[model samples]
Target: MANVTVVDHPLVQHKLSIMRNRETSTGGFRRLLREISLLLGYEVTRDLELTTMRIETPIEPMDAPTLEGKKLVFASVLRAGNGLLEGLLDLVPAARVAHVGLYRDHDTLQAVEYFFKAPTDLHDRLVIVVDPMLATANSAIMAIDKLKERGATNLRFLCLLAAPEGIKRFTEAHPDVPVFTAAIDRQLNELGYIIPGLGDAGDRMYGTK
Candidate 1:
């Protein structure tokens, strides 16, 4: 639990509950994901460093606090991660964005990357990885591995929901990376789905399934 943070804001829970309903429409699920992501963003970025800057107020000049360091990077794990990325982007329009596309190999349940495009200054930026669900964590693990290979150091992870098994594996694989999620559902099922989860996030958000 030391490496994980569960965001228990009331609005986050309410929106997440709606998303879990089996009857929620694709449009509704996506809308709620975007909405809840803003609330989660609040906690995930709470510790962003700030430094004083010369500023001019209506009354007089002042030293105002502004974000310090490289432009923040939001690295989304393809499709499902895109849903969560929308709201965070709204919160920080100046932040850079990255997409890491990965698909699970059916036979081995392993992640395979098909696409990866990120900012060149990853080493100097604070990267926040987003994915709607951290079920098996194969995608997240591989995504982080690739990010590190590219020079990313300061990093955090954000998700809407997580499974205990996934969290265990993720923390063990990268204890330095902190995780933030709106909810931690029950254990994963035999088929690798989070129990009591909002179903397949990509399918629900895109109506693909």
Candidate 2:
């Protein structure tokens, strides 16, 4: 709770409600996620560092604010994370992208990394890890761990929905990394799915079984 920011904007809540409906089509679910992610992206990047630069305008030259340091990085955790990644990119098109390919081993609910690709200068930029659901936090935790190992210090985790069990494990594993999400659900079911969640985000977004 110390570093978590829940984006509770009306638009976000409205969109999430629609996404939760089982009747919503795959196309609709994907579209709503992209829309909600922009709102969430707004809050997640709200406190970014800004510096002024002198620039010429039609009337005169003046100091205009711009983001400082290197371009921000969006570390997407595999297929599901790509759903949120699309909107965040719409929000900041110049941001760098990273993909960490991981999938949950159902029996153990553990994360197994198969692929990883990211910018070489990770230590010089702020990394925001994105995933649609943080049910068990296994993938999220492992993704962040891999990034840190590659020299990323400033980082944040963003998700559409998170379970209390997942949040607890995540925060405990990485206290320094802040978390942002639209909602924190009651708990994770025995099978490691978020209760009352929008169901498997990857499945819903891509119409997969």
Candidate 3:
């Protein structure tokens, strides 16, 4: 089974607490989301491959190590995912950006993809899929499925918060991909929202509601 890493960093926990409060102002919520996303991005890139090369420094010759292989592709799962993408890009400015949009049908609860754009050689790059919440796992699963269809084999999923049911479903569906989240909440409600989650991530991020 794929591993689901819940970041226990104090900074992540603190920002998440502020985001969860009902009284948190719109500005605060947005800022906190960006900050938390940056922190989570740090953890997600911990195992990035590195290679060493000899370099001549001002003082002396030295062997320096740098990242190896093709650059990463930060694939955002549409509107809500944009909230996480901004911070992640701050850390990996060289990474390519891709967008995939999926909407859940209110009646059928099925994931419907509306948009997708990715690098031509997706299989060679490390693809990190970002979204603010993992609720029912329908959208995340569908988004990843689309990536696989496009030849994306090296992939990871990042989220600010996740529900247990969503995590289970995601791991079961893609055991090869790992998941990183700031926190794991309880379960999804009937409406397919993570229980005690920060409401609708898209709505909160954009102050839509």
Candidate 4:
């Protein structure tokens, strides 16, 4: 609760509702996610630091605001996270990208990484980790763990939907990492899926059931 923000804009909520319907096609789902992510992106990046620099305009030269430091980095968590990545990039086109591939060990409910590639100088840039679902937080925790190991200090976790159980465990595991989501659902089902959620983000987004 200390660092979590739920984006409740009307457009986000309306698009989320459409995504919840089981009949929504894969293309439709992906489109809605793209739309909703832009709104969420705005909320999460609202406090970015800005610096003034002299610039020339049509009428005259004046001091204009620009983002400080190097371009931001967005670490997307595998397939599902990719859904949110594009929209966020649209918001910050100059941002760098990182990809992390992970899967859950069904028996242990742990996350296993198969691929990891991030940009250099992670320590100097703000890293925003994106994932569509924060179910049990195991994947989110592990993903952030990997990023921290690579010298990421300023980090944030962004998800489309989150479970209370996942949020509790995530915050406890990484208290320093603030979280942002479009909505916090009621609970996680027995299979660790968010209740009343839009369903498996990867499957719905890519039609890869």
Candidate 5:
């Protein structure tokens, strides 16, 4: 895909395989999600702009490279997105956080927003939207729309798995926003679930039915 980046790192693929196994316990699933997310986060933030700063090392003073501009924002799309958010935070502890609460209405497969809270200056920072799955893409689309309305100009979407249908819909909806994922699955099932995906991320992570 032109705008999509699939992180095919060995560690990522290994963790994702474990997560896809139905026999994996909830605690195991949760732990793997957090672990793989760190790897995925590394790829997503690879091109972050850097600036040079003068700092004294143990040996001598020199210009050190540091992230430029304002701290980036991680916009998590509701409950499931929190899985990826936790690990990304571990990587960038100083990054700003945003929460966009959206749940899929199973009957219509539409997203419904229940909550939203973000920094007031979204226009000035890079916003990376994180979610475990992008099956129907309804929730991801709506979450980004809300963030744009709030003045988020530069944005990206990150996920553990994505269906071809969902990727097409997401790219068409927001062409400028790049997508980062661990894997692009075969397709979406009739019920809007990613085929071969790790089941419902929220249910698996929380040990709920």
Candidate 6:
């Protein structure tokens, strides 16, 4: 089984609480999301490979460690994922970015992919797939499937909030990939939205609704 990390760090929880409040302004929401994404990115990158190198400090030469050869490729699951991507890019400015667009059908609640673009050497890079919500898990699973088809084997999924059902479904479908989330909500409603979740992350982030 894949490890599902619920990031209960006080900072994450505190930001999530603020995000859940409906009265939070659009500017505040966007700012908080970026901050939370940076925090989550830190945890998700904990195991990244590193190599030691000799470097000269202000006073003298010293051995320092830096990331290994493999560069990161960030795959954002469209609209909302872009918000998360901004903060992550601030941390890893050199990482390449790809976009995978998916929308849920209202009646079927299935993920329908409309656009996908990724690096040619996807298999050689560490890929981090980002989105704000993991509700039905349909979109995330499909996105991962497509990435694997494009030769991406090293991958991780990161999100701000996830539903329990979505987590179970995602892990069952892709046991090899680990997942990182700030919080896990109770369940998805009949409409496929997570219960008590901040409604429509995309709309919330963009102030479209």
- Model 4, 1-209: lDDT tens digits are 87799988999999999999999999999998888888999998999999999999999999999998888999999989998998998899999999999998878788999999999789999999999999999999999999999999999999999999999999999999999998999999888889988888999999997
Across residues 50-79, which tens digit of lDDT does each residue of candidate 3 receive? Answer: 998999999999989999999999999998
In model 4, state the lDDT of residue 69: 85
lDDT of 5: 0.96
Q: Write the per-residue lDDT of candidate 5 for residues 69-103, one digit (tens) a residue.
A: 99999999989999999999999999999999999
Q: TM-score per candidate, in order?
A: 0.98, 0.98, 0.96, 0.98, 0.99, 0.97
lDDT of 2 by residue, 1-209 (tens): 88788899999999999999999999999999999999999999999999999999999999999999999999999999999999999999999999999999999999999999999999999999999999989999999999999999999999999998889999999999999999999998899999898889999999998
Ordering by lDDT: 5, 2, 1, 6, 4, 3
Worst 10 residues of 3 by lDDT: 1-10
For model 1, the superposed segments whose C-alpha errors exceed 4 Å read none
Distance from true location, Cα of 142 in model 1, Å: 0.1
The reply for model 6, stretches above 4 Å from the true place, is none
Error at 170, model 5, angstroms: 0.5
Clashes of 5: 0
lDDT of 3: 0.91
Candidate 3's C-alpha runs over 4 A off are none
- lDDT for predicted candidate 6 compared with the true structure: 0.94
The number of clashing residue pairs in each candidate reads: 0, 0, 0, 0, 0, 0
Q: Candidate 5 vs candidate 6: which has greater lDDT?
A: 5
Candidate 6 residue-wise lDDT, 87-123, digit = tens:
9999999999989999989999999999999989999
- Backbone clash total for model 4 is 0
